[model samples]
Target chain A: MKCWLLILLILFSQSTLSADFAVIVSATSGIDVLSSERIRDIFLKKRRFAQGKRLVPVNLLGSKPPRLAFERRILEMDRLNLQQYWTASHFKGVTPPATQASLASVKLFIEKVDGAIGYLPIEMVDDRVKVIYEF
Target chain B: MSFRLRVIVLMTVLSLAPYIVTMIVMGNVYRDDYERRIRDNMTHELDITNERIEQSFQSLRKDMAFIASLDTMDDLLTGDLDKRITNLLVLKKNDMQLIGWFDVIDTDGNVVASSNPDRIATSADSSGLFSVPIRSSFDDNQLGQLTIHYSFENLDRFLPESEHSHYHLIVEDQQVTGPLNTDPVISVSRVLTDWPAVTVTLEQERQFAFSLLNSAENLFVIVLLVGIFVIASIAFFVATIIVKPILQLSGTAESITQTQDYSQRVAINRNDEIGQLSHSFNLMINGMQDMISRLKAENENRIKLAKEKDRAEMLQDLSTKLSRYLSPQIYESIFSGEQDTTLGSSRKKLTVFFSDIVDFTSTTDQMESEDLTNLLNQYLKEMSDIALRYGATIDKYIGDAIMIFFGDPKTLGVSEDAKACIEMALEMQRRVRELKSEWGAAGYSKPFSIRIGIHTGYCTVGNFGTENRLDYTIIGSAVNLASRIEGQAEPGTVFVSEDTQLLVRDHFSMTPTSTFTPKGFSQPIQLFRVISSGVTRSEIVIEESGFSLKLDSQELTEAGRQDIKTRLLNLIDDL
Candidate 1:
């Protein structure tokens, strides 16, 4: 009975973890609806500008569900692959996205920074930030 | 104290006192200076350590601010998922040789990136010693803080620890670097300007701080002792040199006193004052020796002179006693070295004299022996006085008689000798007449009367005796003639032989008496009575068998003369 309960808790956590997340920017940024390839290029520092505006990207620390989903859906890379791509990009004078410890910090960074973008849980996003790409 | 001891003491005091004082004072000064220098050194080290800590903190702040301003630090928004900021922090830590962690903290106080990877995503345990705020490069907004979690061990390089000194980091009034030294010789603390709650302290141990001073003081003490020893030794040597000669001089003086020998002298071989003293002493000794010898000579001379004086006195006494036995002339001649005493005789013309007290034995028989002695002595003294006055040499004294002579030892011519002898007899007769009255007054109605006789002829006159016993008397007929004449003389009358009368007829008045023949004389000697002096003629004497008269015109007063004239006229009428 303990194992069944444990199994059910895992399933419920999985569903919650799989909920929708979005790439966000400040509401005043005037940037919106970025494509998944454009979002990947921006996060990887391959594209520094979007919609004639300089772009800044941010990431959550470690493998959170939103970051993983962002890497899988927007960058089309897994953790290992994205890490390799950033490593390669770093040598090329291109760095990976900035980091925040939590989705709240990511949302705050996006709201406070100009041309800034980061991935967070859709529930964490507010009127202060706008969604650029979804996963 | 003795001179050497005094000198040594004075020298030791004089030499060592200043040295010891200087050593002590200098030692104190050096100790103080060394102590001050040590303290200053500690302070300097503390200041340097504080400067280093401050510089390190400043460098750390500047580096943190620079790292915060880096675009790479913007990765904090992604929570450093790629570990970019962490990699940079690690590189900086290694490059700066930092011993502590560098961290990027979120505004929520969670560490997003750190030099220590394990600290990432964790809440910071403490506020860092140095911090800089992370600002968004795009918007210039402060996102989080860049900080260093400095281990006190990281400050160990700046805060040196050794046997002599130690360092500590004080945080909020707490020693964070091991245990704090409770008691230290020197302690200095400095607060960090960037981190007000942090302090750097340098501490020095008591033993280590004063070690140099202790060693310096010991060396000074050793030097002082050595100086004292050297001074004492020099003082002893100098004192011996000075005092030795003085001691020798004193010893010589003492010996001189004990032995009563002024010849002793001090022996010195120096050319200094002590040598001069010795030389003067020797000169004084020489003077004393000379004075003593002179005194001795003078004493010997005095003794010899005294002995000579005693002999002269004894000879004078012998001469005085012998003069009574001899005539003055003979005595003078003998003592004056003019004559020699010998048993010899000479035939020379001499006038001999004899005198006797008439009926001396018969008169004195009726008197006491004392009276007799007085009368006899008186008579002899008077006769001898008269004899001596006539320059007669008294020959001998017989019973109641005195034998005297003239012109033997000394003579005025034969005639003058006879005259002088007759004059002396007349004076004797006159003196006898005067003494008759004196004796009559002295209790004898029949006083003594003396009779004198004189003769002039050739006789043997000289010392006439054996070699042992000698007599200076005449031994010839002239002497017998003078004696027979004296026997025939009337009492209180002077009689002379024909020879004497003939020779003295011009100088004295004389009357011829009957001749007398003496025993041992071959011829009858004619005698004459010696009356008054012919030169004066002041007296006339008349004598006969039944009556005698004497008249002295000079002696008689007018009344006496008149009385005598009347008596004489009556007597002539009776005749």
Candidate 2:
């Protein structure tokens, strides 16, 4: 019975990745393409602003799929490893990114805030929040 | 205590003092420094281990990203279960330890397909993979799940030798069911975005034993050895410079005191306190030697002078006594003149007198020899004392006789000898009477008397006779005549020649003993008894053949010649 559970965990953990979080802007915004390194730098909170617009990196609720995906793809780390990394980084005076819950909330925050970056499935995205890059 | 012991103690203390100090300081410094160094090394080792562990994870993430971009994971994501299992089996064969599974979960959070389908059968959290409500690039209705559990070793190939691990996969929101012995592991999960199958979860174990042992062992020995070397050398140098000299000076000073010798000194050349002390000690010893030598020399000189003084006093006494035994004229001839005492003879005018005890041998036989000798010596000693008192010299003792003289070695005057001779005769008579009474009291024989004869003329008085044996004697006719007169004299009386009488004619009243013609003499010699009492030099009265003289006072006074002429003239009418 426990073996069946470990296999499920392994399969689920490998599939639902949110490493490629999207950077959203206004549909009529002037910003266009960004390199994979630039997107990584932005999602990892290395670059605070891009092209005179303040970049906001949003996080999913704890233990959520997109949050884990965002950590693994953008920050290139697992949830447990990221927790350890953030704990060690906090000791060095660095804080982790902010978090929110639900795809609806991600879309609402992205439409209202310029240069807002968040992660959701492509179906949940809207005209109000234009996708700047995809994972 | 002895000098050597003191020195030993001082040296030992000096040597040990630094060692003790070194022990104290080294103990303090090494304990703190070693502890601190150990802690710092531990911290640095920990930091390096942490960094290496982080690097291992970073490399694993990059590999996972690359694998996610591979077309293989995408195919595994969308393929049938059999196909995905076959594909993952190939991937697992490539690196079996870390890549535990390759599975796919549908948008309903179900494990639709998997390489290890049995391993994920009970995994309830399909949201850990790409299984939540999310839009695909083609449309908002497309959602998928992709999950990969790489083997522990495959996840991080750059794990250091100290960080090798045996792992157990931990399923999300599910119980771990693998072998428990595969432990001491950390489970890591990554969420993938573009290629859902790129999501990975891994378990790894880290060990830091090698780095800790290296840091602790090597650096401790190096730092400890360096600290000990520096402290030990400092301690030794300090003890030698400060303590060694004190010991040397004290030892040498004590040695010098023991021997009281100035020859040895501490060999110090520096201008320091101990050096000065050594210099002073040398000076003190030198001074002591000088003083001792000076006193010794002076003491020897004093003893020498005392011995010489004793000899000189003895010589002076001998000379004074010898002068009393010899006539003055003879003494001058022997001592003052060049005539050798070992040789013989000198010509001079001298008076000689000889007196003898009558029947002296028979007289001595009646009494003890000591008493008789004492008696005779007593008589002689008294007579000699009188003779010296009268300025006469004792020439020699012949049997019981005494020979006396005057005017030989040195002369007093023309009449001095005659006067001494006369005074000696009077004193002898008085001494003999005293001895007779002393002998009678001792119950001995009747005392004996000394008879003496005197003559004054030229004689030889010196050491004379055979070459082998010599005597200092008067050897002239004058000496023989004096002897003859001594023999003729009656017992208890002194006889003198008319030559002696003429000299004392006014001084003496004497009846002639008789004329004697001896075998060796051609002429008869006349002698007289020196009148001893009740007679004045102014008048002479005597009866010889009924003759008496009453001399006129003027006639006796006019003649200074004992008034013999007046007395004879007054008696001439009867003649």
Candidate 3:
């Protein structure tokens, strides 16, 4: 009920925030067309590919509900463990997924970058950014 | 025709004849060659197009066969769901640009898979594509056919590009596609391999052979025409060389024939055959001219002779007219070139005779003028005829008196001349009697009597008077004595001078019949009468009352007396 209430309150505050999110890639990414397991592997930094293309995972703003839902549903891990895993992966020449404060920045990054993978709200997704996976 | 023109025409004909034949032959040959070339080219083109089509079909067949042997094709046919045969076909179709599409057919003639999946279940359209059976390689099993639709764009690229020749495809004896040329053309065809079920045709324009022939004919005509002109010019040049001398010779010949001048000659200096001919022609002309000149001379002589003959005939007519006026002795002397017409007198001894009708003036006065003229002319004509017969040249006649002379222009001798004069006088008297009787019978009854006188003496005998008007005569006292003696003589009597009596004494018996004193002479001359010209014969004379008759009995016959009696009786009855 609290989660439903938070979702409603976030939706009711339409000018500022939203609950739904979208998984996207750069419009020209070879990695845009992929399935669910590959999406999970890309966000956990467990594998660097969907098919044979390089993968990119993007985050929403901190404490966004879509990010937590992505960690629980797609990664099947909590946010702190995912962060710890990414931090530990950095010493091995690995990096965690990047974060963007707004869907617009994420879309901007996706439109400008090649082989980039991210998630945004379904409502925010457009031709500039391609949706590869959804949670 | 002029020599140059003739020769030029001849040479032109001769030179152009062969060239014309050659031109025609070359035109025909060119046409034949072009036709042969076009036919061979068509045959070659047909072969090339058919080979191209065969190669195209073979390549398509190989591709289909390779595709049929593929593992994906086998796996897909055996129901392996993971295998993507249509995608493989898409890659192959893209690789070979001429392949339109491919269909994998099951044995039931159904398309199980295709590059166009929408076309898989629906009936496949294999209208113009090659449908090759895709048999399994391992078992020779009957796999479904693989229908391949070849791109027409690629087939079109195989067509030959030629202006003279074109290529086309014929399938099942029907024209499916053709070369760009649409008009009528010569064509050759060849069927391709049996699998393609098509024929390749090559076509060429109908006028191709003639086009080559046209160019050849133009070239032939140009060359032959030029050759004709050149040969004709040369022939004219040669003809000029030959004809100049011949023309000159002809000119000279024409002039000679026209003017009849034989002296003209044609000059030639060369030694060729024409020069020889000119020389020979000149020789013949010279010979002819010689003959012509000779004939001309002969004709001139004949004309001169003819003129002379005509002039002689005219002179004869003039002399005959003058003989009536002049004495016949004078006329003969003048015409015989013995006497000149100049007025000069000469003395010659001549016997002169004079005779007249007795009392002619009294008798003639009683007669009419016309009857008198007739009587005078008759008397003169009879007396002159006797005179001429006896060789007495008549001198003159004075009003019925006739005077004659001999021994002047021509004479046997003086004696012969006198005797001839006497004989002539006797004959005159006889003819006068006859004429008188004839005149009396014609109604003039005057009894005509004649008196004769003869003389001989030296007299001037020549042309007398002016040179323009002259008379050939004798003029002297003898002439006067003869006339006066005739006046004194009785009718029917003849008398002569003493000179004539002496000269004719041997030939006649003479009587001193009369004497006359002439005015111009101082002495009287005695006139002797001639009694007879020969030995005396019997004679009879009857004279009474102005009627007189004389008869020579030696000349009378019995029959003649009887005739005279009968004539006298007839005359009495008329009286």
Number of the predicted model whose lDDT against the real structure is largest: 1
- TM values, all candidates: 0.47, 0.39, 0.54
Cα lDDT tens digits, model 1, B1-575, are 99999999899988878867887787778777877787788778878877887887787788888889987777676677557789999999999888888989989999998998889888986757768899976556788998898876787777656866887788889888845666656777788776678787777877777777667667877876787788789998999988888889988888988998887778768889998999998998899999989999999999999999898889899889988877777787778876667878889999988888877778777888898888788888888888888888888788788988888688899999888888788777777767877888878765777788888888987777788987777888777778888889887788888887788788887778788778887788787887778857789976454576888899999999999999999999999
- Supply every candidate's count of residue pairs whose N, Cα or C atoms clash at under 3 angstroms: 12, 40, 5
lDDT of 2 by residue, B60-99 (tens): 4555444443333322223332253345544643564544
* Reference-based lDDT, each prediction: 0.81, 0.60, 0.73
- Residue lDDT tens for model 2, A1-135: 999689558645655763234655555555666665676677666776777776666655566766665555557776677788778877876555544445665565455445666667666667776777665
Q: Which candidate wins on DockQ?
A: 1
Candidate 3 lDDT over A1-135, as tens digits, reads 999789656644752454366678877776546666778887777777667876656666577766666776667777678778878887996655655555566666466445667777788888877777665
Question: Taking the tens digit of each residue's C-alpha lDDT, what string does model 3 give over B299-390?
Answer: 99999988998998887898899778876776787789887788888888888888888888898789888988887877778777788888
Native contact fraction per model: 0.12, 0.00, 0.00
RMSD of each: 13.9, 21.7, 16.4
Top TM-score hit:
3
Give residue B539's error in model 3 in angstroms: 6.5
